[model samples]
Target: MSDFIGDWYALLVLLLAGFLPNEVWRMLGLWLGGGVDEESELLVWVRAVATAILAGVIAQILVLPPGALASIPPSLRYGAVAVGLMVFIVAKRSILAGVICGELVMLIGKWWLG
Candidate 1:
């Protein structure tokens, strides 16, 4: 849109704000990972930190969702996740099967409950 094109400085700032953290982390990972062994303490710490951050984000989403998922009950949300995991494990980690099974479960739940 013309408005967006006219606001090029704002767009540039937004782009940099979004990209810089990921770029910094990627570059740092490349720098540190080049010489480091997989079992190194720093690598382990980084992995643990990343896992914790991801878990926190997932927890927040589950506990306090926004958008369409917010309309679904927490129990159903967790149930879908559990069912998806079971399907994934049973199907030897087939991503498609897991996704389809989870979506099917949600659809069924919505139809039956709503």
Candidate 2:
């Protein structure tokens, strides 16, 4: 009984410690940004910057992959990204489709090459 209570107590503490703080900021952002126009110049610039940052991160991962990803070969990595992008466009910009397709291509390429 004590062990059960201790386990739940630890879980509650962990949840509060990790989740509540992030949620507070997210809720605050939602409230503050409620009046912002999506088509405004500021939002457009923010979107572009976010996209650029995401592209940079992806490029870094492909060019200088870490751990097991490094063993997959650059050609496969590039091919995955290309195929993923194509699928993303073809699937009406579905992020899930693109990500899954890219991951599948990478895994299949690695398996076949080895």
Candidate 3:
């Protein structure tokens, strides 16, 4: 088991195969995206849709999470979101600050309650 796990050649092959498709598209996008207007209406709509999708996924996770997240109380998850959003708003809508504070509150709640 250890020999198979430690095989560098196999690891390299797996990593390359996993990244090849996405990385190729990313490289192509970098090459071709130069002419795209950042402020275009289509781009703005795309961003909005992407953000909405992300929010939907986060809501699903908090409301009906699986495995380890399921073990944590739902109320705690809701609290984490509330506090995180509050932090985000209080910190002038800094996404990083909100995410970090929300995660910290969840972790602390888990630790303190147990």
Models 1 onward score TM values of 0.78, 0.60, 0.62
Q: Candidate 2's error at 24, in angstroms? A: 11
Which is superior by lDDT, 1 or 2? 2
> Could you tell me which residue pairs clash in candidate 1?
none
Query: Candidate 1: where are CA atoms >4 Å away?
Result: 2-17, 29-33
Q: Look at candidate 2 and tell me the lDDT of residue 64.
A: 97
Give one clash count per candidate, in the order shown.
Answer: 0, 0, 0
Q: For candidate 2, which ten residues in a row score worst on lDDT?
A: 2-11
Write model 1 residue lDDT over 1-114, tens digit each, in one string: 896587778878877998887899879878877676879898799889999999999889988998999999888888887899899999999999998998899889988998
Question: Which lDDT tens digits does candidate 2 get at residues 9-85?
Answer: 68898789988977996797798876877699987998899899999998998999999888888999999989999
Error of 1 at 98 (Å): 1.3
Best by TM-score: 1
All-Cα superposition RMSD per candidate: 2.9, 5.6, 4.3
Sorted on TM-score, best first, the list reads 1, 3, 2
